[model samples]
Target: MKANIQYAILIAWGILSVSCKKDNYKAPSGAFSGRLVYQGQPVNVSYNDVYFELWEPGWGKSTPIVVNVSQDGSFSALLFDASYKLVIPAAQGPFRSLTDKTTNSDTILLQLSGNLTRDIEVLPYYMIRQTKFTATGRKVTATFAAEQIIKDAAAKDIERVSLYICKTQFVDGRNSVATKDMSGAAITDPAGISLQVDVPALVPEQKTVFARVGLKIAGVEDMIYSPVQEVAL
Candidate 1:
């Protein structure tokens, strides 16, 4: 009975040693970073709403590693050095996906080594331009221009244009202290559009606010936005 117990203890030690070896594998050391851009400009979207995927194809039953794009349209991931197929899934943003000439597909092949920074270019339906913000007493006004980028058969009408103001830099549809919207039909001159909304009393009573203009495309899930601007009250 004593000899049988000694053999069982040896077997248990071997199993634990193998488990520790598997857990000691090195972590990913490569850094991959990029931004979504349109015509050399960042295509800002709603926070945590837009994301892309990286698929490493060598292993069988491959699963996509999801990377979330920030509000400023940037993404970063630490990965093991390998070739990955980058894909922005269909119907993700308020823009059309670019085609990869080599594959004639939506997937763009990327080879990452150490640190890589590449911009993923997309075609937006409309871009908010020339945004200016000002505060007069309790009211804040935002003026901006909208330029339609897609004029072909794929062009989409604007659902609405909105001005958003918040105490922080995260000024969007869902997160704002004040917001105002303008209908698409009311926009006769796309070159010049303006909106005004009254700022409310803050809990801590601050004098600075961040603002931005967002243009929602008809039938699109996401809205294209301008860079955040600071307004002084």
Candidate 2:
């Protein structure tokens, strides 16, 4: 009986060891990088607000790998070398998601072997252009043109334009020290728009601040934003 129990214990240990080894696979070795582009120009968006999904099929796994786009509209991910179905969920950004016809869905199929770089095109409702930021005394002013890019059945009216200023480079509606808004009704000319926000006293006292202009569509949750600009206080 003692020999039999020892033999059983050894078999169980061997089983557990093999299971652990199978589960402990190597990390992903391939990389996927790209940008969200419109006419070959990168679309600037709020950091971490926009993302895409990558689903690796044939693994009996339905969960997706979420990759967030950077402020400059670029994204990078380390993935296993396999076939992936990439898709951007509907109404997830300031722009419209492109649908893939072959899959009859919004997914774009990718066969990544080592490293791949491809820019995904999108149609934005509006593009903030010619942004200029100036700081005078305790106020920071922003001047930009809100160009309507979509003018069809999918076109949306402007909801509001905002000027956001932050002590750091991450300037947005949520991470700003000062902000100013302009209603859509007040905007007479889309080509020329101006907004000003009073800067608050920084706790650490800094001479420079980062700023950007954001354009919100009437029914859109994500606002199209301009590139970050540095201004001296």
Candidate 3:
């Protein structure tokens, strides 16, 4: 009886060991990188202006994967090799969401496996054009033409223009250490615009200061900005 019991136990242990052998599974590895464009022009997507998201199926109520968009209207992120629902949330950028248009759906099916370079087109409320910046002793000047994406002069949408200055390269409305502005009045002709900022004498000398000009359209809630540039102060 003891010999028979030992034989059965050994057979059962062998079966269990084989069943528990791990399966060789390889995870999908891929990357996505792209720019945000509007009317064939790349947008200067500032911080917190937009997001890149992926919604994997079978993950009900799961948090969406997100990636940050840099100041130059470009973004990149890693993703698994699978079919996922890709979406860009509305009203996150300087422009209105392209999702509002019937032909341009904000969401799409993406099959990620390898590196990707794509552009997400948007309909901006406005765009800055022909921007030039020059830094003189303790002062910086910016000149630019503002082009409204929704150009109805009668709407009187442009609220103001401002010059942002920062000690580092991350220059924006919220990140600027100092600012100069034209606000509280309607901009009748955004096409013709100029602004300047005088760096504070209290600031210690640095190798480079970053600067940019930003334009605001009332009710847009976000300012469309010019390209940030390094200037010698």
Which candidate achieves the best TM-score against the true structure? 1
Residues 1-233 of candidate 2: C-alpha lDDT, one tens digit per residue: 99999999999999999999999998888899999998988899999999999998888987899999998899999998999999898868899976667787678999999999999989899998888888789888888899899999989999999999988888798889998999999999988899998998899999999999999999999888999988998
lDDT of 3: 0.76
What are the models' TM-scores?
A: 0.95, 0.93, 0.79
Q: Which digits, one per residue and each the tens of the lDDT, describe model 1 over residues 1-233? A: 99999999999999999999999999999989989999789999988899989999878636799999888998899999999999998879989998879879889999988899999999999998888888999799988899999999999999999999989998797879999999999998999998999999998998899999999999999998988888888
State the TM-score for model 3.
Answer: 0.79
Off by over 4 Å in 3: 1-28, 99-104, 152-156, 184-188, 202-204
Candidate 1 error regions (>4 Å): none
- Cα error of candidate 1 at position 153, Å: 1.4
Worst 10-residue stretch by lDDT in candidate 3? 20-29
lDDT of 3 at 21: 65
Error of 2 at 50 (Å): 1.1
Better of 2 and 3 by TM-score: 2
Error of 2 at 106 (Å): 2.8
List clashing residue pairs in candidate 1.
Answer: none
